[model samples]
Target: MSIVLIDSGLGGLTVLHEALQELPHERYLFFADNGNVPYGTKPKETVRSCILSAVQELVTEETKALLIACNTATSIAIADLRRLYSIPVIGMEPAVKPAVELNRNTGKRSLVMATPLALKETKYHDLVNRLGDTEHIDSQPMPGLVTLAEELEFDGPRVQAYLQETIGDRDWQEYGTAVLGCTHFSFFRTAFAKFLPPHIELIDGNRGTVRRLQELIRGREEAPDSAAAAGPVVEFRHSGSDPAYRERMEQALDWYRRDRERAGRPRA
Candidate 1:
């Protein structure tokens, strides 16, 4: 069966990218809600509504399974989405545990750069809890980061400027391992490297998320062969965000198309 991945913004494709790499033989669809970017900051109820709407769209659009690639949305609404719809839903929790395990093996400190909501939401109680707030683990609030992600999506100049403005005055040099708590944050890895030393580590949980999806797919008897033609295509659905935001999102998507074509790479 075709796999469908849904994120509140374009960042979710980072997870989709890794999933495809592991299962290149599998057909897939990736949907990013660029219009509703930044689900982390929104209320739980609002996130639920938007996520439900997206799942409904996919169901009507003929997708078989759904992966909630956005961590914030997953933290808040994954269970409800599963209950409301028959489609299998996969959720994302912080990858701190894996990072911690990696750090202990490598001898490095772990610091998580996630949004405020991610830190505050106890509903995200399902956290792997592998690591603690010990010296190895540092969680901080960088709220407007999704905005920075949107900027990066369109190659906006504010990207570098925004990073410098946010991190220049701070001391991020202390941590060796940095967990990109949000999916969108994965796209800004290059810019983040500019601010961090080369030895610093950047860890993301997209791969783990994909593994869960694989397990779900395997359990489904009706699931289609991943080798079938990849007909599951995804698009942005801006329910009620700013018009300017929608325009910028469309432009960024166009850029993705052009770049993918030039590189002879399939859109992830």
Candidate 2:
């Protein structure tokens, strides 16, 4: 069986990457809507439409389910998509529940790092409310990191500057646990560690996503390929106005994978 992980940009790759690590045998397909890289700031209607169209185009009947690997889309668009589509839909959520659990003893305020849209979305608000507001959660929106992550394939100093400027004194030295609310943010986990103390924890929501998907469709068997070895091959495509720019994006992503593998950054 095949599963499709859909997102508006490279951030979804983080979830895709993580899922591959956990569910090594599932045949997978990942489609990044790079034309609309950052979905956090878009209007609800626009984001919904974009995601719906991409999902329809990529999810063949042969696919087992869909994983919306984006926090902004999950918070705003998932419910609507589930109603219209018959396939199982799994989406990313902030790691507040676990972060608060770990933060109890350490007393460092729980840190939730996400895109501006993720922090402001309806689902995110509902999550906080569901937790009863008792936990001391510090929500920090790092918009520059994503914009920088896209360029880190090319510009390192710019990305570093953005992180240094954004994450000042009250960082790893302070927060007990930091949750990666955005799938794209997971890609820069290494650089993030540099900013955070060795003791601080960086957690992403991807592995949980895989476990949930496994529970949702437990006993099903399709093609032998689904139960075979995992191949972490990502096909990059761009629908931008500039052809050269699209090629550059693919090259950059390829470069990151190569460098990450060499640096011994864990890969799917």
Clash totals in order: 1, 1
Q: Whose lDDT is greatest here?
A: 2
**Which candidate leads the pack in TM-score?**
2
Predictions: Cα RMSD each: 4.6, 3.2
TM-score of 2: 0.85
Model 1, span 199-246: residue lDDT tens: 776777887887777787775645445434453333444545566755
Write down the TM-score of every candidate: 0.77, 0.85
